[model samples]
Target: MSCVQTFADYGFRALGIGERALPKTDITLCEQVVLIGSGMFWNIYFALLALLLGFVAASLVAFARNSTRAILWRPAAIFIFILRGSPLFLQFFLIYETFVLLPKVGFDLNLGFVDITVETRWLTRAWLGALIVLFLNTTAYTAQIFYGALRSVPKGEIEAALAMGMTPNQINRRIIWPTMLRLAWPSYTNEAIFLFHATALVFFSSFPAWQQKGDALYYASYFADKTFNPFVPYPIIAVFFIAFTLLIILIFGFFQRRLNRHL
Candidate 1:
């Protein structure tokens, strides 16, 4: 097939928009490239969602871990330890099995004012269940980075804020928080890249790809399996991921610059 036609067919294969069946025989280079590139849609989706949502959870956990109160610190510390200590591969399996054991009909939520049904069957799918695992894992990992930065946020600066008659909330919001983020920016950037790379594990682990709509690595593996040629497919994925990671760094660098502007 011609290059354009090859792309036209497999370009959206990963999204299930075209090419219901992948190339079984005579897999061409264009097919591998296009299919694997298309699969990046899932990778970007998983990474973006996990990082954005995980940061909120991580920041809260970081604050809790840094808190002087044992009530808050202990639980945060324990949660971070459990997640950071365990392998993500095992976490995926454990979480998937736990979801499997839950009632397929889902659980009920009664808020007195309202009631909600939480679906559990969907948790077995990679899109949701693997996402939850990745989210929690990234939160725990990033929380430690933020907590360390929080600790190093210069007590003198905080005291200066207090001396200025600033309220605790004001100091935290206007001063401490920004400083913590500035200090943590480099590590935070690394965490974002790490989480993006980890998205490759989603299909490989407990969560099965519902309709062969897996991520970049998944399609790359599929092509490799069919062609019995790891060289083209694997390197294509490497190049894609490297380009994606560099873009991430550039975006994070923009934020890092903003954070350090006042310094």
Candidate 2:
């Protein structure tokens, strides 16, 4: 088939939106590129949502850990230590197993006013389950980054804020948070890149890709196995990722520039 036809056929195969059967024989370069590109959608999906959610959670955790109160900081310290210390692959396996062991029939939450039936089955799926793992993992790593940045925030700045008659809330919202973000952002950008690359682990982990709808590495592996050639498909995957990584750097670099504009 022509490259255009190949693109049309496999462009969205990863989403189960296009051709159902993967190319078994005579898989061309166009087919590999298109299908692998299609699978990239999932990688982007997992990375974007995980980073967005993780950022907020990390910020809160950072604040908790930075607090002088032992009650607040102890649990946060333990959480960061556990997640940052453990291997991400093992975390994925353990979390998936934990989800699988939950009652499949679902459970009821007895809220004061009403009962809410919470389903457990969905947590076993890659979309949600792997997402949770990535979210928590990134949160732990990023919280540490933010916490370190929080510590590095100049004490003189805090004193200056106090001198300006700023309330604690105002001081945090105005002086502390922005400075923390500015200091933490460069490191966070690297974390974001790592997280996006890490999304390739979803299908390889215990979390199965429902149907054939897997990530770029999933489809790349398929082509490599079929053709008995690791070269073509894997490089295609690398190229696609490299391009996207550059895009990420550009986007994050824009925000970095904005944050440092005052300097």
The lDDT leader among the candidates is 2
Best-fitting candidate, scored by TM-score: 2
* Residue ranges of candidate 1 with Cα displaced over 4 Å: 106-118
Cα TM-score of candidate 1: 0.94
In lDDT terms, how accurate is model 1? 0.92
State the TM-score for model 2: 0.95
Clashing pairs in 1: none
Model 1 residue 18 CA deviation (Å) reads 1.1
Per-residue lDDT tens digits of candidate 1, residues 31-89? 88899999999899989999999999998999999999999999999999999999999
> Mind giving the per-residue lDDT tens digits that candidate 2 earns over 112-207?
899998788989988899999999999999999999999999999999999999999999999999999999999999999999999999998788
Give the whole-model CA lDDT for all candidates, comma-separated.
0.92, 0.94
| TM-scores, one per candidate | 0.94, 0.95
